[model samples]
Target: MNGYGSRGSTPGQGRGFRPRGGVGRRPYPQDAQEAQAARPRKLSCPPELRDAFVEARDFLAGLIAALGLPARLGFGGVDPARDGRQITIEVRSLADAPDRPDERGPDGRQEPGDLAILIGKHGATLDALSALTNAFMHRNNSRDLFFSVDVEGYRARRVATLRSIAQRCATRVLREGIALELEPMPPSERRIIHLSLAANADLQTESIGVGSQRRIVIMPRDSAPPVEPLEDFE
Candidate 1:
């Protein structure tokens, strides 16, 4: 008599075998509910700020219309820094019409294009428009406010990309025991990188260089030398 059956048998393949619980199974209903509840609420402007927000939004809308761009503007809300001194207003563009004939360039020559002309090379035109808007707001109001203009969510997506790069650089710094330098970026983008790694205790971040050459450097926390203790003459 053969000791083993013709079919090869695994320990768990017997007729009474029972699979382990929670293996290859979806999360429990309570777990899913808790995760949904943990999500953060959307940012909203304070009651006091609503009037100012509306004013700014209307001003921008009028400006856009005056430029002859067929786009609608919407306010995303104010993001106030923890220090309360800085606030950024998000402006989203809703392009609803076909491209119009290009408007005259600064030199009186007809430039061929549509509202996209506003989003110049790397958004230079948009930046210029934002600067003008900010100046207008300051001149008309008692409060000195800073403004950032975002066209079609460009800034939001850029921020997300910067955060991903920051994370990758941080991981490299922690694993390789060496410092890594990121390409020079504008102040707003640099802030994103700094915030992304702010919670990582194992990594230290610093911005070096000046002006456009400035960039972020990530190094291991232990890379810095210990401070020497001062001697007491007495």
Candidate 2:
């Protein structure tokens, strides 16, 4: 969610987060499951898809090792949608991950190596890794698909946390009868908040702000006024 779409004179912090789809109730999905579900499935499995899956997993394993993580993977699996594809690989442990920065080199000191650090501020690095995997696997793609990487159970845990945050904020908003703002979060997390509260008929959720500073505002449905829609990318 980008650009603050102010709702009346409600008081809050600097503008908050935005998510996929344009402003105005865009539900482009915020999590891996939703993303995979969004894809259209093919009726029959294509032969090349099996090869693609094997190729993708093997490639991912190599990529992980090349990135300096070895034996850290618990396992990875594929979720084929009739004809589409979704492969998820996991980095199970950071026990072997360095707690300190690497030796100095011409490029300057390297930061400590950990899957968590590689996950970036909001799974940004993970997204990049996914894109890279797909790029390498594109030739094997007899069908379009989505590829993603997760550290431990981070994504799943985060989804649960976001839902908790949403519920907590919603309760406060309803109790106080005023709009409330939440801490800044990425589009994916924001999407979870939106999805978690989507069923409440008495409440409304709005995302505001631009770039990394964006977030969500919880307010009453009857009191919600029209605000320009915002768009966000995972």
Candidate 3:
């Protein structure tokens, strides 16, 4: 059996669940999927990159097992992301036991015994792992190495969701001719927002704030809100 990273979108809570970010976000469409901005695309592990890809795959598998998490790794192929290529491997849960609360051993440090822990509150740990792995590879390899670690297919699904949300927000921004702010997101998520809106000329997107407080604001090409049509009164 396979479960995606973090129990983000629950079965019944899909309609209500929004990846809550910082407070004070103005109302927008709850269903980002309806925006139709994000479309799924496939990537292949180029033969030239196979050796490098396998190196990361084996490293993460051993690390997970050493942590007492027996997982099956799936190579998600490499894709262009940021400066380097993004290589993702899906870590599937071999055991379906419910996530256990963080516990400290004799040393007094919390141990990772569940896949959920790898995902963190809002994928903090997951993002960290991606950074860590890339750093590890960079030190070990002469050529540039960029790797993104994901539990199951969370990264794939997340990419789609982010694209959708971006499109939804961009749609409203264009229609209302008003600038809108999205909840705070990590760099990877924010990247998705920016890439998703790159094709739209009527809208402009930028990141504001610093560190964890950083978020995206989508604005129409013009600052002033567009005039309301007479159709509203009729």
Candidate 4:
């Protein structure tokens, strides 16, 4: 997920738009009632693991309180199985967020004021929050954790849009015989592009850039020889 660099070009004019996991499979989780029936009172986790999630939830709650933002959150218990070597945390803002665009400053480029502050330039704030949550979990649990914090449904909608853009770019790259350089995107979004194009034999892809300026470059697959055996890998 961290393959791509941070933010890229504005997604608005990319010509096309609108669009997780290992083993290519993730099992369905049991309902709370059914799970309780199957494994009653098995919710106990190591204190460290338990606190990792708890502290994360609490930290966000405290932040909301400190900012005087009205939000109601229900802390569903954490699943130890799902809480692995890396703790994964998810936060959703109960209140609907307003759409505020960037404003132009004296400089030519528009300065992202509130939106940038909220998302943190290049999503750095969100990333830092994630890291802090992971650190707290790892320090107590002695295991690393991966956390994702989403304001409203931003992350979900972003993923959907990225998938569509990746597909459209892939198609264009195949047809034009010219490489397409996408606007910088988060590492997770880049992963979506990679996965979307993984099966296409007609095209080859690679990401280029540094930090938040990184973008994915897609081009036609030359009639090249096999790099490695498919069976040797997944």
Candidate 5:
């Protein structure tokens, strides 16, 4: 006999075996269907802002191409902050293009040392790019629009690291009953440090020093008993 014994006969058991019901199809759960139907959809952006973001993305794309960089621009999003007075356009580098001196490697992996060239010491290059892009927008009469260019999510990761450092230093200050001074950071980074410690009542934050030398000082609050004044007697 062949693999099939006869018409409508089970493959292995000959005439005695019968096929089970619903063998080819699994039933979908009603609750899961309901849940899927109830799930919320993503909200769409306002038309004017979306158009402006598209224009900004195209502008950056052309600029990157002109610079001969082996990278492509990806739109992150447009975020409005400072009570909607300021708009920030976030752009990411795709970096799928061929290896460049500071981009990729022959093995198709990112080179740390090369990437440091673009990021610069303490993200100076990245900040410069952001400022330059914002200036471009201003020159185009975009007005109040800013741009932040990040390669491979570097800025996001750095912000997280800064916040963690702030928390750890705050904890140490609370325990040691002494103040700690952090290394000099940019105004934006210093703001991150200050905001990270803002909610802790046992510690306080202060930024001091000249422009480039500015840093954050995490200090312990003095909660000790007050000394009584030695009055009278003369």
Candidate 6:
């Protein structure tokens, strides 16, 4: 006859609508479960946000030490809380220049070639450094954080280089009737080409292949685009 009595039985209660005490029982409705199920999962940042670029800087740190390079260096993380989701963690090293050196560039730039060993061999070494840093950050972060790592501003410079290449490729596609295929590049690099040529009406861009083989292709515009052709390209 307690609270459960009189009418029909309530959920998890006897016909009298009575409450029960047990090892794993709750009196309230399963509100938490219902709320959790109703909520949607969201990513903190887009795949290309600065927070996610970790593949470059970490490798440089290890490579410099192993190859016996200059030791003056500085590394840190930057979480500006950009927007609600994105966070940028910048790790840098100045092998030639002391981090807090009294003498600084007239323009306030870090000393040059401080981490030359890190940017070795046509950026092969630099690329490795970026990859290693990303791997490390991913392991240490509480949640799956995405960030880009730069060694001596390599990523920034690379972005400019990629944009130039994208423009040239787009031009070639417009001039020639054939499609232009670029060398394989990272996903971020491919995105750069896509964005750079997004406004091109005469030519369109698309990415193809998987993993290491993935690359961007620029093709002439067509009325009915081909299955994998970019935008209006056929």
lDDT of each: 0.50, 0.54, 0.57, 0.46, 0.50, 0.45
Model 3, 1-234: lDDT tens digits are: 221222211111011122234334333342443222112123456677777777777777777777776665655656654444666765655442234223322222122336655676446777787776777788857645577776634555456656766776677677767677666678878888899998888887878889998977788875745322111000
Model 1 residue runs over 4 Å out of place are 1-55, 58-68, 80-127, 144-146, 224-234
lDDT of 4 by residue, 1-234 (tens): 111111111111112321111233322222233212211011233466564555666766666566555443322234355645443333333221122222222222223222223344335566676666566555755554555554332344345545656676676566656666666777877788888888998887788779977767777787433221111000
Q: In terms of lDDT, which candidate is stronger, 4 or 6?
A: 4
Can you rank all candidates by TM-score, best first?
A: 3, 5, 2, 4, 1, 6
Give the local distance difference test score of model 1. Answer: 0.50
Ranking of all candidate structures by their lDDT, best first: 3, 2, 5, 1, 4, 6
lDDT of 5: 0.50
The numbered model that scores best in lDDT is 3
Write candidate 6's Cα lDDT for 106-130 as tens digits. Answer: 3333445445445543245545655
TM-score each candidate. 0.55, 0.59, 0.62, 0.56, 0.61, 0.51
Candidate RMSDs in order: 22.8, 14.5, 10.6, 14.5, 23.4, 26.5
Global CA lDDT of candidate 6, please? 0.45
- Off by more than 4 A, model 2: 1-50, 74-84, 94-113, 224-234
Clashing residue pair totals per candidate (backbone < 3 A) = 0, 9, 0, 8, 0, 21
